[model samples]
Target: MELRIGCRRPPEESVPGLLRYRIASKIVKRQPLGGTDDEWVVIEPVYRAIELLEQLHDTPAQEALLIGRFSFNVRFKWFKNWANSEASRRLGLASIPDGPANLRMLRRTLSLEMAYRPGGVLATKIYMKHIAVATTEGCASRPGGAQAELLAEVNQHESERDLHLVLEEFRNYQEGVLPAGPGARSLTEFFAGIDAQLDAASAAAPKTQRNDRDVLNLLTKRAKVLHLGPANYCWFTGPSRALCLKLAGTPTVDRPLIGMCGSARCPQATHHSGHRSVWAEHADRTKIFLGQLGTTRKTERTRLQADHDRALRVIAGIDSAIAIEG
Candidate 1:
């Protein structure tokens, strides 16, 4: 059941012929074919294989066995299921009826060693050499077909998810869940204004259908100009240049980094009626703390006062913005 990497000999108590062997020259070499003699190279594809393995499965390696070797153990059946699931996910295929058998064929095609002890519920020891050979063969054989299909499917899924989220945000604005901003009165008016902006942007862009990249670009432009602030459901508020850049391209709804939030100056931040109570409470608490500070603690009191002033300014700004719209 234990998977180990490297050429170190196992304990004598272990079953005979269980250790798969490869020549040291095959593991590493100075030069071969047209290569220069001064250049040393690792003949074994361990790092590349491990990269592929990590991408396919989330299993953590248990421990280092020896030089250039690591070990981890899994139940034989679990390993089979894991391989099958990994293949299915990567290939974007429905679960095949003969997953284990297909995997065995794949291993055979790639000339990977699958040495196991003779038992009903045996544990197989798979090595880096076997994994490397199999992964290389799989990649070489498929080249573009399965991998391309997977990439396309992934892109489609992400695009759909992002589109849904943007629509949901628009819906929230329409439902009064989000605050009204400048040049918009009721939810209906806001929606109309947004539609008009989108129309204008789309007209300015090269002709494209709704789902085309050009249209998406138009939508992104409108979204940026709208400067619709964070919804009530937002978990964090901050200066969001990174978030803005990401959304300008992909339109995801990822949470902001709380510790990095520069709320006062954040372009993505908007204070609404719903957030007034929170600001009020915070300001009140900060004021109380400021009042309790003695003259000797001048530095501490100054810092608290600065925070209080910032909070009050933010509150005033929000009220002012809302009043202009009203």
Candidate 2:
């Protein structure tokens, strides 16, 4: 920080670089002391205040040289009083927040800002799964993720770009192209109901604004509510709560860790034909791996077999849904 004085001084002090004291990055100016002719001596008090804020969060006895003779409570109280002074109030700056704990809130905000950047999802994937870093987990397992709620608000907006794609898929689904996951069965009904509701709403009100695009807005709300994944749909309107291992023992109802979803067995999970190719590949890979496994690896074999079976079941469900639609 460079503290400047309005009063005239030596010619060398004209340049800020020539100043004897330089610490943090801010601009401070000296002014009158308590409406008197005496100078307030802004440099020392403000510098110490900034230092106390910087190093005092984790410990009080930090930077003895910078924060000389300043106790933990007295420094903060002095700063707060100085901030409320008539001259300080004239600056119209927001008061400095309580350090560390309040500043940690920034980490949570940074998580949001970072997650929405150009490659935020891929970049922040590890951070989201981390126990400490805040993120909205679909596989996420955040017990009470405010981050998840923020993402929902974000997705509600950006998902608009893909609404037409969802409509196109719904309109021209394949003969056996079913949604994937256990919730697959309800997808067709939900779409149909949405259309019917729009039609009825338009008829009942006559002037009510409604279109396929507008009708599909409900999907955005549903997506937010169910924590829908981009690659999969959630037809979770029935008895099955969730089969995510993350939610197994937790008491609080939070975002389902969609990454850990029991896709085939979970009652709420559903995949559409869009996801069929991936499921097919997964099943095929597991089948090939099963062949590669020896008899001694029973556990591995059993796990692979279970995965294979789940994939097949999910594929079958998709086909069944599409066939029913036909």
Candidate 3:
């Protein structure tokens, strides 16, 4: 048996009728009002009766039909989930309120008209690009507007000076606690080491628990090891971020930074609260061990100290070079 895939819906059918039929068919399959797939078979005759005019008009128009082109508009449904807790069972959906609508149009110049001859059937294949035009007023209830304003304010203040200063301050905090030596590394190195550690832990996790506690614990550990003050940081580190999600397709050279925060506050704060907990407990330890910034052995203390001092100078110099405006 051969399968024919029509490129577009019949043009003789009104856009509204075609869309209604498409949506109604999906609804029936989805059993939105409640019924098994078998129930659809029973109710299909009634639906056909309701759409008698469409069927009758389509049959005659399809015969010996010449070249044609057409377009359509449609409305659809989507749901947004709202969860109540970090560990919860029940999920609430917002129903997208108005379920915004979109429009799509296509045109085709057929080489031959096959609608007229015996055993000839007008078959269509449609390709549509749905562009959303308007949305329900309920969408305004979201904080997206406020977020845009906040982001604008942040962008205005975030001079290169700020990045340099932040790195400098971070270095100072590390140096004050650790012995001076050539062992110091940048925060990026520190995080990169953590990534390796997480990999090892994930590998060691039992297969059965791989997707549950074992993985969750690993993430929580990572978040803890890389804690940076109270601000939230959203790093779109190209492949680095993708690595965390098991999708290391292509790598990037320079990491692009985009600030996505409200007001002057860092956006990282708004991230899931438990993220830190997961990273610290399971992932950071792996990185620290793997990255090996310093060793506590007394024999290597002097050597390590010297290395630490050199590293601090680099960080401090980099920091001192940055000028910040109040």
Over 1-326, each residue of candidate 3 has an lDDT whose tens digit, in order, gives 01012212222344755422221222233356643322112133434443453444444342222212233231122112222233233444223433333432112122012212221121111111112211211222222343345457765555333444334433333344321112123333453454466567668874533333333343343333232223223333233432322322344633323322220222222222222343233334444443464555554555555544433443343333332221
lDDT of 2 by residue, 1-326 (tens): 12222221223354776543334222222434322232222244555565455454444443323323345456557877778677787999557655543334655665567556655543455543344433343333333344556568777676664565556655644343446555655665666676677778889999878656675676665544454554465444433376664457543445566666666666676677677788888889999999999989999999999889978887786666666654
Model 2: what TM-score? 0.46
Q: TM-score winner between 2 and 3, please give it.
A: 2
TM-score for every candidate vs. truth? 0.31, 0.46, 0.18
- Per-residue lDDT for 30-142 in model 1, tens only? 44653331211222354345435444543435432222332322344555476579766797766545534444465554332222212101111122232333353343343
lDDT of 2: 0.57
Off by over 4 Å in 3: 1-152, 158-174, 178-246, 253-326
Candidate 2 wrongly placed segments (more than 4 Å): 1-180, 199-210, 217-220, 226-231, 235-240, 245-247, 323-325
Model 1: how far is 222 from its true place, Å?
7.9
lDDT of 1: 0.46
lDDT of each: 0.46, 0.57, 0.32
Models sorted by TM-score, best on top? 2, 1, 3
Model 3 residue 124 CA deviation in Å: 38
- Model 1: per-residue Cα lDDT at residue 229: 32
